[model samples]
Target: MEQEKDTKSNGDDVSRLEKYKEELIAIHHKSQETFEQQLSYISAGSLALSIGFVKDIVKDIDCAGYRPLLGIGWVLMVITLLLNLVSHLLAVKFYRKSISEIHRNEFVSSKSDTRFDKITWLNWTCVGTLVLGILLIIIFVNHNL
Candidate 1:
């Protein structure tokens, strides 16, 4: 029957949609993990490299004039690291809340989730601060050289 065929086709479409949704969710989670991990590593590495550069390479130069720039860069890097940590914690809470809501058959969209919003903001802030910190460090090194 044509009607029967139509019903079967609709069911197939629904299942395919569900499969795609699951795949997308998995990819989203993986990308988030990668972003956070990579950013943290880069920020920490930058801090260490800056310190080593000053101690080993710029040892003879009087860095007092541009020291404040380096100090601010260090502070920014620290803040980036702290914000990344807080974002991780918030992400955990968000996932827990999402799971609970799913178990309860209550759907809360990510746009309306405060924890999700905070995580998003924290991620942006971390990137911004890291970039600013790197720029400051570059300026400090240039001045010393």
Candidate 2:
């Protein structure tokens, strides 16, 4: 019957839409993971490079005036790294909670999730701190030079 065909077509469309949504979600998650990993790598690498620069390149130079700036930059970098780690853990927790909710037939909305909000805040904070830390380090080095 034409009616039956229309109903079947509608059902197929709904199923296709669900599959497309799932694929998009997977891609989003993958991109987020990649972003976090890169940020972590950059933060850690910057910290190490700054330390090495101070130890080897500026060893004899008395950067006493700008020492505080360098110290603050180091602190910021550490904080960024810590925040990244915390955000990653919170993301895992959020996903686990979401999975449990799905299993219970409860709809989980990311917009209403405090954990997701925290993760988002932490990620942005990490970006801010990392940029500030790098800027301070650059200023310190330039001033010393």
Candidate 3:
């Protein structure tokens, strides 16, 4: 009976480990997908703002004396774009590291465990920056109008 209980306990541990690994993989995939979407949207918006709206923005600023506000808004949007890119890149880096660790059956260190948290922090920072950027742009446009 003692031997049997030990074997059963070992089996349960293996089962739990497998489940944990699956959860980690799922979270990693979701993070990657979310970051990609953010990066793409920001990249396209920034490009459009720069290329399609520059002449109009300049004309509006010349007429309205909101040059400083427009400049600040544009700068904020650039910062948002950069933050998203950095977050996406770092997520990819840490995701690969996680997969490599799993494949090697290596023990996870405390530092390695914090990678996910770091990723989350980066994502939130990107989002907050994006919101601030949009607010600046809105203020600029309203002023220009």
lDDT of each: 0.89, 0.86, 0.71
Q: lDDT by residue for model 3 over 81-134, one digit each (tens)?
A: 776678778877887897798899884877687987887787777677666766
- The model with the greatest TM-score is 1
Could you report the Cα RMSD, in angstroms, for every candidate shown?
A: 1.8, 2.1, 3.9
Q: Model 3 off-target regions past 4 Å?
A: 1-24, 46-54, 57-60
Q: How many backbone clashes does candidate 1 have?
A: 0
In the range 44-145, model 1's lDDT, one tens digit per residue, is 998999999888888854644588889999999999999999999889988988888888888678544766878889999999999999999999988876
Instruction: Give lDDT: candidate 3, residue 96.
Output: 88
Best by lDDT: 1
Q: Hey, what RMSD does candidate 3 come out at?
A: 3.9
In angstroms, how far off is 63's CA in candidate 1?
Answer: 3.5
Q: Per-residue alpha-carbon lDDT of model 2 for 26-142, expressed as tens digits?
A: 998998899899998988888898888888878864644588889899899999999999899889988888888888888558544766888889999999999999998888777
